[model samples]
Target: MTMGTAGLETQPSATTYELGDLVAQAWSGKVHVPHFQRDFRWTTKDVLRLFDSIVKGYPIGNLLLWVRRTPERSFTLGSLRIDAPAYEEAFWVVDGQQRITSLANALHPEGHLHDPFAVYYDLAERKFISQPKTREPQHVALPILFDLKRLLAWFRTEGEAVLHLFDEADRVATALRQYKVPAYLVRQDDLDVLTDIFDRMNNYGKRLNRAEIFSALYAGPEDGAEERLNLSRIADRLASRTGFGTIDTDTILASILARRGPDPARDIRNEFTSAGRRTAPEFENEDQDTAYAEGEEALVRAISFLQNEAGVPHLSLLAYRALLVVLTRFFAHFPAPEANTLRLLRRLYWRVAVSGPAVFKGSFTQVSRVLCARIRKGDEHGSVRGLMDTMAEAPRSLPTVERFRTNEAAAKIILSAWWSLRPRSLMTGEPYDAQDLSTLLGDQKTAATAAHVIFPRGLTAQQQLYAGNRIFLPTATDPVSEIPVMLMRQPIDLDDRTWDAVLASHVMNREATGLLADGDREGFLHIRQELIAGQLSDFLDRMAEWDYEDTPSLETLDFDNLDELEGGDDHSL
Candidate 1:
């Protein structure tokens, strides 16, 4: 199956296409974006940069197309959807889907302005801007800029205000029309060869991640497969099922590997093949269906344990994804371990969160191997013991949070601790909605998306990003970023008891609320920080207790005394 340059159906023909022509072709379904291609991942900034490069006459990268007939299907190219018709000799994009999607959607009149593609050309500044709400004289919407009739109409209106900007606008429009992207078209029948080419291109550039690469090899449905074992779809399914939020497929893949074997880094292309194992692969290398199915179910159970038993309500609050991977393997092997074992497992979770995966010493792959090797198929207590054995000592202090980051370990730990208090809205006595929390934090990998600044507009940079200054107020659609704290529209007329309850729910004492009401930002922060630290310490200490006096095994436990040992848990957090 080694793909060489030779065994191709059609010779490579490198040529250029008018930018506008390509956009038209894409809109009319002359070119097909394959399922193996990564999603339209470029941000508005990235799209603007691509446009900027074209305007400057810089060479954006060449596109690779495999010329063949593609069956019609409803698909998404960025936020735009196409219910395509079957086509003959449709050029299937083997590379550069990102650039194609950006150009097609940004330059099309019907492209959704709601998503980031709504671009505008700023004639005065000579730059591309994203979703300019202000009807500026110098700004021409990209959809209109690319259309001759619309461009002239725009000139008659907003353009009339700034007569000097016309020449620059005209120049940019011409550049948009004349812009050419170098593309290599190959008429190859064997999709395997195309996949190889695609892999080398994206892998070398370091664009697609490992899980994406793993999924690409099996990204069928071009010729019609029953269903796809898409990692993205699996993660999305889990997110929708539980309010715990979306987990990255890369982390999910680790869970899959943990169930299958000790080494998660083994080549996924050969996951169920002879190359992946010393012994013969189970089900004769056709266990992909079983493997992913079992893996996904186990992952669901692991997430339930995290949310229900460990007080970690969302994926964003889980300090380490590796912890989930480990739990996935444990749960996959033993669906319901004894109550004592479950309690010990919860303790192990907190220890790793406060300290880190550093509890297991090695590289990522190495740590995965070591942790996964500890789980046994039928031996529940032994598996729990192996994991608990890793945590030799509990962390004496709560994790420090110099800055608030959703994905970072320390910040996730802090957020999880605060979430245990079930932060209520200041205006309402109700607890923050888990659905709202999950929705806001779902797509974020940077600073906590669920977190917002308590103080509006007036804090220094250091004070603003300080971990203490951030709060998870999920119910607020629009944060009070513009108004002063005391001047905010949140009802200040609540009775003192109601105010006290609201303050308590936010992890703030009455003193902190009074300070905030009095315009004492410094005092408010200090008081809140102290209160948060105390609560966080108490929570961590409770989870750190290594209650290890259980019988040697699940069978060894005396049936009569079991109730006493598990009664205090009240069936967990």
Candidate 2:
């Protein structure tokens, strides 16, 4: 350690030391970890990589330690090689899961480092063996052996050659003990500083998902029958499940409101949590449960609509807000106490399919108004029934309703419509076409010659990494840190020039790019003629056929005969 400009004293950390030293100190009763810490489960490969880097003199990461005044009861660590007390007072390992485990394995007296270390070598006889007598038994590296007596005993029997082996092991251990991986030791008791440091460091550089980190921190219980009564616990679980990454806090609040509807508890929770939540600065305890229930109900309704009626294959981060809107309307007018009404929901779904995502996203206000209108007439909202029936009867396009695009309002209507119908092919402009995955992927390369290349500007690595196969905003650029490795999931043969040319062609045909205006999601479709032609050619050349278990059928729905459609199905309302 060295002092900075402030004259704060620090030790001159050695770059070389004995692993036995750390082991001895630990066995002497220095507990370095807490009970909540995960156990040592590193496989041979994981350990080997650490050693390999050490051999090359690469600096392994530092051990983050929370120093405490007193140590607690101890246990043997890492294959029972070393014993140490568990840290009980007020300290924990905030980072460095890998390096510390490696160190623990290397120096413990009881540890066996001689199981097997995997390395490939050509054999005189044409076969691979882990060692002289061993067949490849999950070739593992023996633990780092550092006991002086053990080294002496083996050396006396095996000669100077054995000494050389011990010497090499000692040297590596020495380097590990002395090598300093950067450690951030925080003093005083402030969880905020620790969390902020952990979050900012990881976010700015390593970049774990916000939900992932939150899951680690606040994760408590599942939102099943047993856990639903606890508001905080239920919210945490819902946030972990439905909330995508950074938007978790908001999603948790939204989920609650979706279940219970408008209430001031949201405001109080918001005060304790953070901004962007549906909570206010204060909420009355008496009203907390009602608000929480409303939120939860909203989420359930939205999820149902998306899964059953909208035919959304999977939920996406972008679609969350839209779903929230849908749930608001569903809970407002229907007596969902029984499964019978859900059956009728199927008939209502057809209207969703015909409406298209664009219309639903845009017409949220009108949908809510309609829901309210129907609620006044009867618990069985006939307005929704009428709307679906009317939309189904036509050689004409789906009816477009205009309304405010308030996030919540929009989500409710969109979800309701989505629940009522099966999703059609966005490409073919028809009901989903029956095709095998092989056929889909194979022809996908070239089958749709007329298909447009969406996201022509190019997809960023972060977007591609998280978005899976979904099309994203074309203008998005991946951060410099995430590239090549992140973007390798798809074929990379198409060059930038080709992408631009394809996009140019699509622009020419569609007039002004036809990019999603509100979402800034323009040029997402790959629609240029030449590009489609090239894709088709590739499909024909490289596509392979795969055997699938069962093919799904598209249901023919008659919205007018609601009772017939809703009543006959086992799962129907």
Candidate 3:
């Protein structure tokens, strides 16, 4: 039965079909997945959910197909190797590629060999599960059971042993054949009109990222000059070379605009569009080859500074991407800074990290523009000083123990700053290696395992549980005996001697531990905040003093051992 397009001036004919029929048509070379469609990206879980929805009778959404009168090319569907007819007219899916591909792979037994969509019916749970090849008696492979002859053979031989589960199997088989998918079939001949319809339909509720949009805009005809400007390829190459996980295309685009355009804050959507290029001549004449080269070099320099100087060796540890944008502009403007200027820049970097810049509202365009202007004028000191001053005024106040739990950026900054101290694990008396921390920092889950609460959350009041109360400890070490069970456990039932032993271990500063031992939770958090603030101040001060002649070392900052607590005022607590 034919249907009509929704919400359009000129309607196109549409149709509907049972899912089983759709899969049958796909296998027999009647329906084709178009070449322009993206690769199948649905995960195993997504596929499983689709089947579950079908069984539960939930609407799986509509499919848009172009009724091609004459096929222009040949393409494969899902992971299936079956040949689609190249010369015959067929229905080409414009929307619902994901759903159609998933249906084809799961319902057709031959489709499973080419794809990773192996699914099973859990006899006990009565749900679909994607399971690896196993001899478990309860799991009935969907492809095998969906075939009527195979299901009958299985019942004749071994079905009686689990005959009770056959009801669920029959239910699933019946649903698979009866489930109907709504479809639309358009007979449009204009390729451009079809492309526009496809894009508008896909982008209705969910918007694509700037990178994806820019990639589409910059992409050229099969053989055109704009093909070389593919933003996605450029970003991927940069990520591979620098070991920075997925350098975002928007970040790269922002750097290019900062270097070549009059205003870095121009509407990026318009800037990259055809109309934008025609209206703004700067985009046409700008040397993208040189801009990309300079941007890459500047990014390398900025990453180097973060790793070697700021103790932030991994991109994941960075609190904001805006910082990178600002740094890229700075480095691009001044490829090399004086030794003193470099020191000051380091302070500014950490300062912004610890206290997230408030000006990140508009992708940091204004802040980046101001800093670029200063750097262009050769006033490096003024640029850094002015930037820091603006950051200080950001809505976020100085970090407190409570803020640590809520603000992820603040927690990361505190953790990184504390790690800079190189505190030895109380159980082993050996310093934690920076390299180990760097590797762990690559992912948040792994990084969290690097630190454990000194006082277990269950033992402390909600207010006492903050950054100050946590201590960094390696989860595992070579000497198994070096692992501290006390730190890992709650302090609730431990005896006085055990408590004193833990306190004396000095995992944190002496003052903070003394307050904890005395059960002064308020005093402990207060003193801990001061100590963290003081360390941040002291570290930045030392960084600002660095000169090319005699570069100041981390040792000079006295972070190896907690010899001098920066804010050790007793009355403050």
Candidate 4:
């Protein structure tokens, strides 16, 4: 393949080497990974697949290396922490980091490497399997078996029963040492060109994304005389603090750019030069130190508003990344608004979320610019008005019961908003505390305990069930079987005391519960939809005070005749 030199193009030289020799080169400071490369991302299963391929005499892949004279820095190999000293010349792996890392970690695991690829060979099954920290019988750790003396000692003590397996172990060791991987050595000095080449080569596989490339361009030393800022690590830290899960690097970069002038939604790579600094006057004159600090503070405030006011308690429930950028810019412009203004802003936030695709129909950049301009002008009313105006054009209707089951964003927003009203559990009649509900929603395992269907799915056909059919029941309430049992009995079979208990325990209004008690499938759906739509309508109205005539309202479906309802055939109670 053609390689680019200092303003010149040339062909790279090729060579072949045994696997053991490559491992030795990495251990002895003759090879290293450059700072621009991504961190090791392969899992234990991937490592096992590599070893299995090697044992089967399959061609793994070729290694692309840049031969540099007078290396600029010292480095470590994989998770082994095998420090390689700076040398006059060293080969830096550019394209085959995953393979090289897997080899180094698997071969030299005895160095107590804190790697994820801990594996062993099961002698009984004759296969490679991922092993835990603790040892098990009939299993030989790959790292320990790399050494002949250790292998012989282990066999003498542990392999006496499976003496016939000695030949298999010897074969595995031979294959690892004798396997030759093709290599290409190129001499290139331009960092930008090297990054381009790396990107192009990886396109055939799991190529690097824009965020990863941006991170590589801006990443600083992990350990140095002066602590340098790493955007990736900073995003991770923010997510941990907010319990928002892992935030994408692009979102973090956009937030930082938003603090400065210009739309953060545009291509970020254009903002940075090859040297990794702002190129335009709008950004060049801005102090990066202040921008980063303000960006972080504004993001925290935005997340707080989302959790406390908007009912979006976690990051997974956040439907759009564009929303974060808009909120970040607003908070950056207006660090703290008055109490009434803050209340208006919170209302606007939930309205936008519930409005769905309408609020984000046009260019996100334009939306961010508009909102930020109003906030900067200290026009809180205008800011809220502008956002609502955009949302007004979209068809704003309460989602159907079917939509809640299928659409994740809608379900999260609706449930979170409803949960915020302190609705009582249908089973226990106890008011749900916001903190406990938020914790349960944030965790996957506990989320199921927060809500369930009043009529068990087994009793009704698919068409009869929808989001309105579900209720938020506290975990401490009566068993789930209790409700189904009462519903299964005839109306006369349930005494007045039991009926009162059922009505009080469920969050449904009296009209909706009466339909359920009478086994009127069509009436129950109509009443439940009206009840939920009414709740949503009231919630939106309470968010802010406005005089706009185009404010969207939830349409309550009414049916004069039960047979006229759609999907009535399969919805018999």
Q: Point to the candidate with the largest lDDT.
A: 1
Q: Model 3: per-residue lDDT, tens digit, 11-48? A: 77666798778888888777776544544688888989
Q: Report the lDDT tens digits of candidate 2 across residue range 52-91.
A: 5755578766555554455344454554433345544433
- The pairs that clash in candidate 1 are none
Task: Tell me the lDDT of candidate 3.
Answer: 0.61
Candidate 4 per-residue C-alpha lDDT over 21-51 given as tens digits, one digit per residue, 9 for 90 to 100: 9887877777777666767788878888998
Q: Against the true structure, what is each candidate's TM-score?
A: 0.84, 0.40, 0.68, 0.71
Q: After superposition, how far is residue 402 of candidate 3 from its true place, in Å?
A: 3.8
- Worst lDDT window (10 residues) for model 2? 543-552
**Model 4: what TM-score?**
0.71
- lDDT of each structure? 0.75, 0.37, 0.61, 0.63
Question: Which ranges of candidate 4 are over 4 A from the true structure?
Answer: 1-13, 27-32, 66-79, 90-93, 110-115, 132-138, 186-190, 199-206, 220-226, 273-284, 287-291, 338-344, 358-385, 403-407, 422-573
Model 2 bad stretches (over 4 Å) = 1-46, 69-91, 105-141, 151-174, 215-271, 274-341, 344-573
Candidate 1: tens digits of C-alpha lDDT, residues 258-313: 77765566666666556545544322454666777878888999999998889888
Number of clashes recorded per candidate:
0, 65, 1, 2
